[model samples]
Target: MDPRIDFLYLSEPDMIAAGVLDAKRCVEVCEETFALLGKGDYLMGGANHNNHGMNIVFPKETKFPNMPVAGPDRRFAAMPGYLGGRFDVCGNKWYGSNHANIEKGLPRSILTMMLNDKETGAPLALMSANLLSAARTGGVPGAAARHLVNKGAKVVSVVGCGPINKACFTAIMTQLEGVEKVVCFDLFLDKANEFARWVQGEYGVGAVGVDDTEAGFRDADVITVAASRLRPLYFEDEWIKQGATILVSGPFNTDESFLTSARIVYDHTALQEAYVEDAIASGNKEAYYSGVIGGPFFRLIDAGKLPALKDSTSLGDVVNGAKPGRADLKERVIFIACGMAVFDISWGFELLQNARARGIGQSLNLWERPHQG
Candidate 1:
């Protein structure tokens, strides 16, 4: 009997060649994924089948000299999922992150993804996933912008000037038309200035750097917050104009009053439920709320400060026409997207297929004969 097994290995360059950086196509694919999610055709890690992923975090202090202690953004994680539909595949993303990587001239997180055949559980492809991760992460907001943002929205305010926000801007540009300006705010003035210049050069939009967050949000039609923070960053209700949509891909900093008043939408309702369950089970509810981007809202619901989450709609529902998106120009909407593993699997699967069609990756033989069974 034939026993040969092989898998495709794709480096970052190969992933780029396979169209990993195609923001428009990535957004479209993400939309498809969201629809599948709404239909319950995906399975993520955890008992509830809606977990984001499993992470291994080190302690802040370790007695052993060889033992590693945790620092900011330092952890190892595995994000696994199965996405069914026309694209039936299972995959896992493995990444290690250390904030100090920046000091070494590298990104804080380095990631790789492995796609497998659902039926056989055989490796299909192993690929660099930093770009895949970024594109899919950005595509969530991009897809929301397509359905939620006001048409011909002219001004966009970006609160973070990091790589993730850069990808978000690229995805937003792909999905929206007539975006005339981008105002950026960052703690580091130089980073904000650099991002402003980048936006101007890349999208030819009028880009400005602002010292104050309020100035960044003033008169903005769409606001995206992608900043990484351990503590909440507050956005006063007065800063948000009527009819503006805020896409939150990072930790929320606003007060309870603003959240209760805004039309809240989630990337997926079940995922948020899972987050709350996990937080409660872990016994430090407040820490989870403060640490996670969408934690506060769920915490408020748990504390009876806000209504139950059933009142909110999932972006997937909107994509599938199961619910309405952006009822009126006067309505204020805030989209909270806690990144999902399905996105990584979906995009990785597509990239793998593209690489195969283009003959863009190396074929590595797993074995010529079965080692067991």
Candidate 2:
């Protein structure tokens, strides 16, 4: 008897061919995953089973030989999870990141995803995860846009025009077909212009590089904030027009007044609540829930300013037709996507299947026989 194991390798281009980069499809899959997450049908890392990942950071003032210095955005991470439901696969995403890589003309992070069989814990596919990560990150917001953005939304604003934002824009457009103008704002003016150019070239839409956050926010029908800034990206509550939708993808510094009044929604309230509980358990009450966007929503719930988080629906509810989306043209809605590993695995598994069908991978044999025996 012969034993053989082969895994598919999906290059970025091959992923595109396999439809892994399709914003619309990615959004749909993420929506399904969100519903499963809401129903407690998933298991991530940590005792809580909702931890984002285990991060390893270097010391800030290390003087040891051959030891790396700790700096901004420099770290390694291991994100593992077992997602149930349709895909029903276990996987992990491991990556290392450093800000200095930008100067070397490379992405700040190099990442990989390992999909595994649920039964024997054998590896399925080891493929490039940068595209996987970006697509899923954007797909979360795309899922939100599908369920929340105003119909016929023509004007859009984007804060932090980076790789993540690029994918966000791609996903948002799938939901808002009438989007004809895109306004972009970044700390680096050049990066904003670059994002504008790409948008115009890709979709034939009018793209403008705006000077201020308010300018990006003003009168826009749909707004997405995907920035990586350590500080908060804020626009006065008065700046957002009625019926507009805002998709907050990263850390947000915003006034509580808007959060208390808006129709707030999240990808998974359980995960958001876990963060709130962690904040409380960590002994930092003031900044506990306030440090994260979801935390602020929870704080409002505690104060009775906002409705119960459970009442605030998930995008999956809308996708599954269990709840309504965009109640009216002028409803103010906010969707928070904290990101999850199940999303990556869902899309990654789909891509791997496609890669195999199209014969698009480099196979490496794991072993000719079982070493454990």
My TM-score estimates for the predictions, one after another, are 0.98, 0.92
Worst 10 residues of 1 by lDDT: 227-236
lDDT tens digits, residue span 1-373, model 2: 4666766667777777888778888888887887787667888887889877777989977769888889778999888989888789999999999999999998999989999999878888888899999999998998888778877788999988888888987888888878878999887788999889988998999999875777878898899988874566777788889989999887766678787667777787666766766777879866766556576677677888887766777776776677776777778888888877888898898788878888887787888887886
Best by TM-score: 1
Q: What is the lDDT of residue 135 in candidate 1?
A: 97
Pairs of residues clashing in candidate 1: none
**Model 2: how far residue 368 lies from native, Å:** 0.9
Looking at candidate 2, the ten consecutive residues that score lowest on lDDT are: 288-297
**What local lDDT does model 1 show for residue 52?**
91
lDDT of 1 by residue, 180-202 (tens): 88999887789999999999888
Cα-lDDT of candidate 1:
0.89
After superposition, the stretches of candidate 2 with alpha carbons farther than 4 Å from their true spots are 1-3, 285-295, 298-304, 307-311
